[model samples]
Target: MTEALAVPRIASPEERITSIIALASSVDGVDIVVAAHEGFTYSVQALNPEYEIYADELAAASAVYLESSWQKLTGNARVILADQGGKALLVADVGEGFTVAILGERQAVESLLDPVRRLATGAPISCPNCSAVLDVHTYTCPSCGKRIPFTATLCPYCGTASPARSCPNCGAELMLAPGRVEPAKAEKQRSAVAVTPRAQSNEGEVVSEEKGETPLLIRLTIGGGVVAAYYASSLLLGIDPVIATIVGAAPLAASLGLILTEKRRQ
Candidate 1:
């Protein structure tokens, strides 16, 4: 009775990833599951057994491309969903560079998004009032009294801003505002406002930048006319073809330089 107790074995990274893949694949409409860490494929599984041959390669390529794009697009994004050829592709970034990719029906993949996000972030989306797990996809709009997905910042049916929602479990008011604004998002918003057209005081008169340079269509037409005139002069007036070509290119070159300089200034 006093025998030594055996310690539980800890699962390896591969095992953990494999388990997560298996869990996702078990969902009804899930057809394939792939797990990767730091752009390296760890496991690949599919409902159809015949896909074993190229699954690993496909998973590796997908992980690399997705990881790169994810870093460039949004550093804090934990989940991404896309549809291609009627199949849904879901990529979840679990913490510490671990990622899981699942392919299945759109509805099924969307349902799994929150669960995967919870697993990766270790933070469940709970109701602010009652601490109940919130299902964003099944949110009920208070204004429209209709159930709809609350993926964006507004209720689609009534066009009401969703700063809060009623908790489905406890019927209590839950705040939908994010706890903190991300630096990148905040900066982007600020930049957008900064770039907005504004009136500037010039000699006590308001000046606006609304009037732009020559229209692109007119510029192109003028350039084409100049070039065509050069060619025509070379043919009809018997001017040296090489000299005509050089003279014709001068105006076009100047126009291009001005365009580039304007773009750089802007």
Candidate 2:
């Protein structure tokens, strides 16, 4: 028994071709591709080329006819392949150039219609600096030497943004696209922690800090009392004055130690 493959249904031609182009682009060696209308006028509505196309290709007619026949009869798409030196094959949609047949390589794009549509419709975001589509948020513009912000209001280098809102460099007002300007958030109230009271306690703390005289005076008094006791004890004992001096100095030392400790506690 063999498993049957699911038939791809395309109700919308534009969406279907878009899916095909996206799939083809994923193929290795695919440079660019496009899908357009199935007519001779050749006004391309969609294309996935390496760069912006200035004019239509002369070889597009043959490719267009081949793919259009497949699409109409077999419900399948066709590809027009081109080689740019050693790079990927540039695949274009056969009929209208509204979709891409494939872009990477023949092997990679064998079953690729679904991918083309996804990619074409969901295009990658482009850089405001060099117009290169970026994968990640970056500060340095990959194409130009510009300092960009993580969340920039304007480009730091050229001072420009998409939709031409304002010149980042010169701060000039720019002509913006319709419905592009986002409304800014209104200012919110500050947190209570941010506000500090100016008034302070008056309990011997010198509401304002100044030179500490109380500590100095206490230290001076202690020194003076110790000196006086030593001299008096030396004169009175006369025999081994050092012992007498130590005895006399004990009380004064104790008082001074208590006073210093008390001041520190307060």
- The C-alpha lDDT values of all candidates are 0.57, 0.40
User: Across residues 213-248, which tens digit of lDDT does each residue of candidate 2 receive?
Assistant: 565566668767876777786887674677766776
On TM-score, the candidate that comes out on top is 1
TM-scores, one per candidate: 0.37, 0.26
Show the lowest summed lDDT stretch of 10 residues, model 2: 179-188
What would the per-residue lDDT of candidate 1 be over residues 3-30, giving only the tens digit for each residue?
Answer: 4222212134343344346446655566
Name the runs in model 2 displaced over 4 angstroms. 1-9, 25-29, 39-51, 58-73, 76-101, 105-266
Error of 1 at 62 (Å): 3.5
Clashing pairs for predicted structure model 1, backbone only: none
Clash number for each model = 0, 35
Error of 1 at 84 (Å): 4.0
